[model samples]
Target: MSKATSPVRFKAKLLRPAKPANAAWTFLLVPKAASAKLPSRGQVGVEGTLEGASFSAVLEPDGQGSHWLKVDNKLREAAAVDAGDTVALEVTPSGTMPEPTVPAELRKALAAAPEANAVWADITPAARHDWIAWITSAKREDTRTRRIANACDMLATGKRRVCCFDRSGMYGKGLSAPEAM
Candidate 1:
């Protein structure tokens, strides 16, 4: 991993969701202009300081064309800020895929199913990222296991991306999103 250093800097105002929405995100939405300056238009590993507290995250798309960096509760408290605050961001690439942590269950399933494993390997890195994101995003273990099973099935059937999932991966496949509505 490359050392964290000065990165493309920007100022953006944090905003609350208009209503109850997908639990998948709660991220800091990086502006389009800032996003355009980054190396990858797809999911990227990034680290920066928000409100003086440093953070690490993946810049993902919101199914729309724009990108966002997820800010979990721990970061929010550490930063001493909340929605409606303007934040300073210094984003640098980590020189690795941001969301590549695959679950053990999914790995076993993939190993057992050659066709699915072949399809998994055949898909683009971006697609694999989406699948992993969906499987990991589930709040419950059962939900995650179901997602893993579903992913294997879909891959075996020659499907590339998950339904309702996109570049940002804020919402898992088959889950309704307020962002989309």
Candidate 2:
């Protein structure tokens, strides 16, 4: 097996739900261990098993010296955990894996739009991942360019992936949007 896929093991406690909205589920987390070597934000291919069910999560650093393991909601439901369940976390370090390189033309276009870059940088890695995935998956260049332009416009205006346009056709700012585009 490739070293890139090797898993690291750690013990974690399921944190108690901070609010009632999250009370239905629990989180098994690595919560900033001073001695633990955790992955940084945007690291991919992280895997773990919670309650005997294996799952994958993306590691995102909170910038306060801690990282979050973003597991899918379906997996969370399957685990039947509540806030504060002690569990184990296993993850593979993000290796020298190649990511889809942005086309030169697209890079130039993005570079020309400073506001877009600023907004894009401010977004979460997961959101950026979605945009990259969409653009790279397009079978045609025209579609990709159009989507890129739209994405740039959305970023410049600080609108997220889904909430760029509201029901009234007006854009709202400050945390109502997904910021994942």
lDDT scores of the candidates, listed in order: 0.70, 0.53
Candidate 2 ranges with C-alpha deviation above 4 Å: 1-5, 19-25, 31-36, 39-44, 71-73, 94-127, 130-151, 154-181
Let me know the TM-score candidate 1 reaches against the reference structure: 0.59
Residue 150 displacement in candidate 1 (angstroms)? 5.5
Give a tens-digit lDDT track for model 2, residues 52-117.
667755554333444555444576667766445565666666443323346676577779999988
What C-alpha root-mean-square deviation, in Å, does candidate 1 show against the real structure? 6.9
Measured against the true structure, the TM-scores of the candidates, in listed sequence, are: 0.59, 0.44
How many clashes does the backbone of model 1 have? Answer: 1
Candidate 1 ranges with C-alpha deviation above 4 Å: 1-6, 18-25, 98-128, 133-150, 153-181
TM-score of 2: 0.44
